[model samples]
Target: MMNLKYQMIIQWSEDKSFLVGFPEFPGQTWRTHGDNYQEAVNNGIEALESLVIAYQTTGETLTKPTFNQAA
Candidate 1:
């Protein structure tokens, strides 16, 4: 796999007793979680890697991450 990077956001869920991670990429949504912060991060990475592979297999172009440029 290419050295691609995607943005990951993690937050604590008071109702779930675990951290939730969301990767900002095309066709990706809430699909990973962890009992703790580290677990969430690890899960997020794995999820992103898997997503990239799936997209490649389907003959879809990889999603390019959006960036905020200062004016």
Candidate 2:
């Protein structure tokens, strides 16, 4: 099993496009127009999976990535 840590933020666009990204994983982003929130999240997950696989293949190690949520 691979250990991956990331946070996602979903935003709506006027043109009916969904934008998603992880604050921790800069440049890791995905967008899907004409999709719902779930669709955007799914796309984000796929992007994360690809990123993790690529990093693991290159023997890069992730050290203690944390996510902070505020109430």
Candidate 3:
């Protein structure tokens, strides 16, 4: 796999659902049905990969999210 240096924030919601999002990739978020944190991270990665491919096909540039903004 290619090494893509993208950062994302993963947290558990109040309802126990995993909330994942890449602040750099605005509007990109995904949720998975599992208690495992790793599962959530994997789902988030898949979501990001899809978004990146879509953006590339359309000639759109991806905006990198900063740590401050993600926080």
Candidate 4:
């Protein structure tokens, strides 16, 4: 997934009282949450790295990201 750049969608949930971020690829759901915006961004990066590692380890090709939605 070296050439791939996934978009991260972030939002603040009043109910959860935290920031949440997730990749925007099709079939992808859920997100990593954080106590603040910066933490949420950090979590999103970790999530993307984890995704890359998983795909690499399993020898599965990751779909190229269409855009970057991170803020």
List, residue by residue over 38-70, the lDDT tens digit for candidate 4: 888778778778877888899988777675369
lDDT digits (tens) for residues 1-71 of candidate 3: 43456776788888887788776765655433336688877777786677778888999987764534554
Candidate 4's C-alpha runs over 4 A off are: 1-4, 68-71
Instruction: Name the 10 consecutive residues with the lowest summed lDDT in model 3.
Output: 26-35
Alpha carbon deviation, residue 32, candidate 4 (Å): 0.5
- Candidate 3 RMSD to the real structure: 3.7
User: Which runs in model 3 stand beyond 4 Å of their true positions?
Assistant: 29-34, 65-71
> Which sections of candidate 1 miss by over 4 Å?
17-23, 68-71
lDDT of 3: 0.70
The order of the candidates by lDDT, greatest first, is 1, 3, 4, 2
After superposition, the stretches of candidate 2 with alpha carbons farther than 4 Å from their true spots are 1-4, 29-34, 69-71
Point out the worst 10-residue segment of candidate 4 by lDDT: 17-26
Q: Give the alpha carbon lDDT tens digit for every residue of 1-71 in model 1.
A: 45655677777786664544444564456667888878887787787788778888999887677666699
* Candidates 1 and 2, the one with greater lDDT: 1
